[model samples]
Target chain A: MRLKCPLCGDRDAREFHYRGAAKLMERPEAGAGEAAFYDYVYLRENPVGANSELWFHELGCRAWLCVSRDVSSHEILSVELADAVKRGQA
Target chain B: MVDLTGLSALEGLLPYEVDGAVLSAVSYGAITSIMPFRGQKTAVNVRLKADGGAALPRIGRVSGPVAKRLIWAGRGQYLLLDLRRGAAFDTTPDPAFDELAALSDQTSAWVVMRLEGARAQEVLARLCPLDLRAGVFKRGHVARTELAHMAVILWRRPKGFEIMVVRSVAQVAMRRLSGAMDSVAAQAVLGEIS
Candidate 1:
């Protein structure tokens, strides 16, 4: 599948590596307790429908992307720069 | 000071030619990577124009003349090169752009080459997956992509394309490009008789 990089345009999927769920972006506070930290670090939901993911464009623009995709159909719903997501711009 | 000899990555393995395409090593006196400080892009562009007679290139574009040009490397990153200068890095930071952008000399970190001729596109199509048609990938367009599984920055020049590969894999990149050239040339020869 081809993924459209916000900066580099459309590129083959081989150029990008899937990091994990987009939830990886959220980090617990230092005093959030061990259970909360453990859930943040170890628990992952394997949803079958629309899922937000983190992908790194290692070979193209080197931008971290937040990709919304359907897990069952493999259709890419939308893509945004992770930086922009963190900044609440995307 | 010790005497040191500067050698290009493809020192003795370039200037290769096929039936219609020619590949040659390209040397730059200095290659500087310019990445603007957060929210300083406009300031950096203004500084670049005042200092180099060119502004920062947009995505997949180049600024200035061939003698000294700034080519877009990726999002918010650029490579400025002096084509006529010696192959060495100028480590000094220029006050003109230092505060607005992060500058680093990258002269010896890459192997640059120019492939030019009528059939250069055909030769490159075999290795790169990008749609390189003249209309699609017009002149001054650039892309960070893979060429034969090696990361490269490919750009369209007037006649052909310029490819920049990491210095460590210069030989491997050369071999892959040369092999593609030969394959394209042979295909052309076969088409003539059939």
Candidate 2:
């Protein structure tokens, strides 16, 4: 299957791995609590609709992408990067 | 003992899983000929039935040929040449790829598995992340890539993709793969060309 890369536009899925979803949830920092870190890393919401996620192109360009996909059909709706700084805005 | 400076052996490469399915590794060495069918390799992978009968279609075929005698024997890749023939490599009427293809076809007698099912794609996805959907990996196609931390030859069959990982890594791959498929289990020995 082919995918529209966030940085390079459309490329084949053979070049990228599906890491899934852009969960901005962050850990509560060190000493905040082990349970908090565990829950944040392990827990995930498997929504099956238009959603955003992360993908690493390990074999290709090796760029991290924030992809908007339809989980139900595994169709990629759109793709972007997690780095807000790439947009150069506040 | 021939001058084997870097030739590797494939022993203990295939290990039996607790559930009883066998995983294996093999090596196809030497650069003999190149056969590309529809841009795919047709190396037949099969499994035997509980009744010792043939079950399903061939796993894959070899499109590009690398050597003459190919062996799924153990855990490593082997490139064999008939050194007995003082004939130079690939300078004869009968090419190396043709001979290897015959050997690959004869192995059809060996029971093999299609390794296909609902989660077959999922199992493969965990290995190479190639997005093995319907359109991408179609029947009669083949790919040589790294899977489950090992080099593997994958064939796209009608039923499911058949793959042979490094025999030494078979056990580890099987364990890691059990978690990939949502389907409960897979068969022990799959048959061929049925």
Q: Could you report the DockQ of all the candidates, in the order they appear?
A: 0.77, 0.03
lDDT of 1: 0.88
For every candidate structure, what is the RMSD over all alpha carbons to the true structure, in angstroms?
2.0, 15.9
Error in Å for residue B164 of model 1: 0.6
lDDT of 1 at A1: 92
Instruction: Name the 10 consecutive residues with the lowest summed lDDT in model 1 chain B.
Output: B84-93
Q: Which 10-residue window of candidate 2 chain B scores lowest in summed lDDT?
A: B74-83
Per residue, candidate 2 scores C-alpha lDDT tens digits across A1-90 of 667654434555766777754664243678878887777677777776877778765443355777778878878787765554244433
Model 1: pairs clashing at backbone N, Cα or C within 3 Å: B29-B85, B29-B86
Which number leads on lDDT? 1
TM-score of each: 0.95, 0.32
Q: For model 2, what TM-score is found for chain B?
A: 0.40
**Each model's total of backbone clashes:** 2, 30
Best-performing candidate as measured by TM-score: 1
What would the DockQ be for model 2? 0.03
Tens digits of lDDT, candidate 1, B95-158 = 6786888898888898899999999999888898899999999988889998888889989899
